[model samples]
Target: MKQTRISVLAVFLVLAMATAALAATEVRMVGDALVYGSFFSNRNFTGWNAPAWTSATPTWSKAGKKTEEAFEIWERFRLRTDFVANEAVKFRLEMKVEDTWGHGTFTAANPEVAIMIYGAYLQFKLPCTDVDVTAGLQNVALPQSKMFYGSPVFGDRMAALVVKAPLIDKTLSVMAGYGRLIDTNRTYDTTTTQVADELDAYFLALPITLDGFKATPWGAVAVAGKDANLFTLKSSQQNSSFYADNLTSAGTYATPKLWKNDQNAFWWAGGAFEVSALDPVKFYADVIYGAGAESDRKKSHRSGWFMDAGVEYTGWDVLTPKAYGWWSTGEDGSTANGSERMPMIRPNWGPGNSFLFDDSQELVKNSNMGMSPVGSWGLGVTLDDVSFVQKLTHRLTFLFVNGTNSARAIRTLNTLMGSNPYFQMGRDLTINEHVYGVNFDNKYMIYENLSAVVETGWAHGEFQQSVWGHSLVNQSRNGDTWKVSFGLSYKF
Candidate 1:
């Protein structure tokens, strides 16, 4: 039924485009041609003998070898056309289709789809300086980080109306707009009956120039509608024993308390600055803060911030050496109790099983991934070889996460009411973990429009908990993973 609905929507969109094309006076089309392909090999080690230094046992891993190999292809096509061009108003239409095919751990057969208004709106350019007014489904502007407010998860698509003007002696431009959060390609289950309405207002100030330094300050507030239902909350009452069918039986009853109020709102603000301090050194830094609870049932308010500061130096005079370091923190604010503060999901473990579902520190069995109070700091040194063969880039990065073992959210879930074995299946399995890895990528242009690439990586870490519990005995293990891949691609 869901698939049928999606197909009907697609057909309706096509017909609408056709009708618009026939009625337009002036038309222009633009697009891009792209073909991308890659191959990969993956391997994971989990079980009693897994890494010992990271804390916890491997409930998801058994003493064995698990591997997967596959290839993938990516293609995208876009079309844009202008319908009306006049002195006071101009209108345009845009459409795009993207498809993918592949195998392996990173591969999926289901092609992702996105359909949007694109540029199907009107723009009124005024005579004063460079000012414009835009209405209808238009582009929403935010800060430097694409992850905030925008569709960073899949594709960028939000509904909004924007106004543009010049400021600061014409040295700065400002954009203010109102937008709403719409369901993306991935929608929740309709049976859930929970809907969320998010309305946001954003403002951006971009300085034209400041002594050769560029800076921008952006801010936004998202007001959730009163009817928004964040998450389902339930409580259970357990009875030790009851007489049933001539036998003693234990019964558990769960009750639901429906919460229908919109006391939750989120505020986000940040700025970024870039400057060239010396002949060989360039500095950049960005800071962002977000606060407010996503739901009221938990009576929990989430607040976190992130900072990215780095300096890059280029040695163009010699080997063209490059070195830089980055630091990032803060949560994504998707979980009720701030589950983003953990690294259990999609950890960079070199080509091995991430054991994402086997986290012992997570209270919830299945949860979204995000930054745990833990922050990652890493430094990399890269050397570019442009003299011969294709451009060769070699990079080495070292990262460390703080507060890895401090995830009380997962710990509390496991110990709920104490001695609940079902809830403890994979809880508190591992403690703080330290990961180190090396990645190498080589790209060579086989022809004018074709290229060949080779990449490989290796990582090793220790687990901090026992895989199996034995009387008076606790044990841990160490593990390592590696992967290699080669592929060819064509671009136009």
Candidate 2:
């Protein structure tokens, strides 16, 4: 696999060099720098005693006090060279890096380096149409948030071909590609060396505009060979009572075997409509259905759907605040019907690590879990002004998520928590969960090209059980977790 990847990269490099030599053009370089830092405080650091309780005993001291802090520096540089010919062809190369520096439990496990072909492709102009082809790492094109069937967190380094055609005064577009999905191999203490097989994906979309309204319909599909080791957990219950003893007795616990039908497939179709039917009031709505199944064998089929609708009242002339909300639900083959999916979470050392949830296994299970729906809705407000300092934006959102069945939720939570060795002695945390939160984000221009942002968030969750799967001494109905965060960011 290593040799194959090297050869493929070498071939692309040779092709790019040959193309560059054939066309003489000027090369331009672009770069950007960002510095981010955050701090967090939780009422229940280890999900033990809640509210405000004093540490009269040292045992309580070891259980309740928790705080986190972190810092990240990210930089990206790219080179673009445009050819000075009739059939202009452009070449681009980009590199990015994220450096994690600070003191925190979570920040210690962050990836030290992530190097890949950001975006590399070729474009040619024709008399009646334009054609663009990409043959390296790239991102997928989908509607809305790409939550249903899009790659938002990672990029695919593959060969892609895209074509655009104009007909009946309307434009049509199509694209298809095959590439290896990049999977990061990092742990709290060490990194692994492995690469999975290649995956294939394709997409089609059409856009039209009439009378200040635009509509787009898109469809996409993706397929990959069974690479369960790429995404599966090494242990069935990481934090379970079965973990430590198994490791001590047998050297390790038995991990679940990836099914033969592990080869995965997904399809999605949806449309987005934005209308100016109302003078100052614009409406937007979209819906999508996606499914993933075992391509190699036949047993269980998984599917999910997403729907979003909202209205924007821009007629508020000076202070135009738009309110919008969206909902997404999916089932990975990990759970059976009427089972709840549990999220596998690991405690981080710092605020930076604490913010990100380790839902990879749960997400995968959601794709295969019989049929479960997870939904969340939020409302936001934005202020758009022409003034120097007033050109700022602010939004407040309320999000709610819950599983349909208590049984399914329990199973999922069990699987997620069970996969971790730390929580092996106990069962997965199960509770009727409800969350309420508020967010504040601001952008201030300190200089001509330099800007700064100060963002903060406060969220609280009420759960029936403790995160450690321990039953409360008193069967009180009210047990909740509180989270607070503040951050500063600078861009240049």
Candidate 3:
């Protein structure tokens, strides 16, 4: 009887060990680094010393001193680690560090550099089914074509849960997600006992793919409490005001304020399509409509439409030529009727390497000279991947932008605010204003995973004094602006 009991215990232990071995986890890591220095002038299109020209009343540019030389170096690094338990389950974590060259170092007598958690998520396949689910913080974007980089409504990192299921193998699928945009500590609100200052969004997408064509139709809805944190929608560092003036009717354009209601509703619908049936000649396009509604405050509401299209020819062995254009509804003369500009949460849309918009810049940081095309229309052309020698390539681009917003709207806002509303002069233009830009960028592969880059761009602005007023226009030196950046990138 004693031997029989011992044999049974040994068998149990053996089975446990076998199960553990079968479930062994695999770990993988990937990362990238970038270091760059940028030399720029007239970054604001108003000279380098424009900051010293501020006053209670707008003054003339000649009364202030201006400079044209400025330089800075920036560095960024990111690492992602993935742990796979099997073909069915996985977990990923990403960390990032980005800042000026010498600011955040303990040895430099400053605060120690901070490491940020860029993403952390778990992904798994449902039991007895093909459905896939991902939960936690991750990068999210609405349905959009690659030509414009991402959606014009919301494209960034957020805490969310996403699920995807294939309806017809690899040809058709459906995706759904929920993202939390803001949370002002509802559980810890000391005043009013219960607070409703949170924002949440839900989305759905349908994707269809054929032999040489693909399309995705998507829609989203968000609920925002009246006191939701608006600052959460802005980038860590911005070239100019993000939604300040674009949220037109909230108050005045010069000093806009948010109007409140118990709860606000925002909705968006869009579609992205790509066609490659024509081989070397390919086409891509996206159309979107978005709106915000408030029950009590009519001036707090906004709605509009936006669309963009692009064509690319990849027949040549050394170069690919592309053309892109975009249009969107803009504000009119009335303030009580609310803004006509398309409502956006955090837009990340652009085309090519043009400096006028936040396109594909190897630097990615401190180089976004142009704001999102909220109330604007543009046309651009690019000659991409022009290689004349081994491991060396160049890209040249030219772009033109014109405002779609009415000048009368700005004029009225300035009068109501009793201040200069042209603070974002070159960034936010009127229908009577325009700007053109050119870019010449170069890249040389140092190794299979390393490259050297050089980017240069220039922009010229055309503004009308009749719309912006002499005081604001004279205070701004709206001459040409330019920049030259050199950088190195390494990846594995």
Best by TM-score: 3
TM-score of each prediction: 0.59, 0.62, 0.86
lDDT of residue 129 for candidate 2: 59
Screening candidate 3 with a backbone cut-off below 3 angstroms (N, C-alpha, C), the clashing residue pairs are none
**Model 3, range 52-134, lDDT digits (tens) per residue?**
21321222233124564478787888878777888999888787778776666322554454667789899999998999999
How would you encode candidate 1's per-residue C-alpha lDDT over 1-492 as one tens digit per residue?
A: 465467459758755765676665445555543444433322222222211111111112222223333344544455666655565566666665544444221245543345434556677877655677777665443444221212111113345677787876546878777665433213563456654443333445464546647677776665544332211101100111011100000011011222234434556666866676574676666566655444544423444455555555655533344444334442231224442321110111111111121111111111111122123444444443324433443333333333223333333432332222211212222234444445455556667666665555554444333222231012213334444545554444
lDDT per model vs. reference: 0.39, 0.38, 0.74
lDDT accuracy of residue 225 in candidate 1: 42
Candidate 3's displacement at residue 64, Å, is 11
Clashes of 1: 32
- Ordered from best to worst TM-score, the candidate numbers read 3, 2, 1
Q: Which parts of model 2 are misplaced by more than 4 Å?
A: 1-23, 42-87, 102-117, 126-128, 145-159, 170-196, 232-257, 294-300, 328-334, 337-407, 412-431, 466-468, 471-492
How does residue 18 of candidate 3 score in lDDT?
42
Q: State the lDDT of candidate 2 residue by residue for 1-492, as single tens digits.
A: 454466457557845865776656655445554444543333232333222212211011122223323223323322333333444456555544333443221245542233344566665555555445555544444544211222221222344665555444543444434444422232221335333333455667676667767777777666544432222222121111211111111101123323344345656676767777786888776666655543422323334455656666667545544555545542232343311121111111001111112111111110110111222233333343323335454433333333222333334434453323222111222224444444444556666555565445454544444333443312222333333322233333
Model 3 has an lDDT value of 0.74
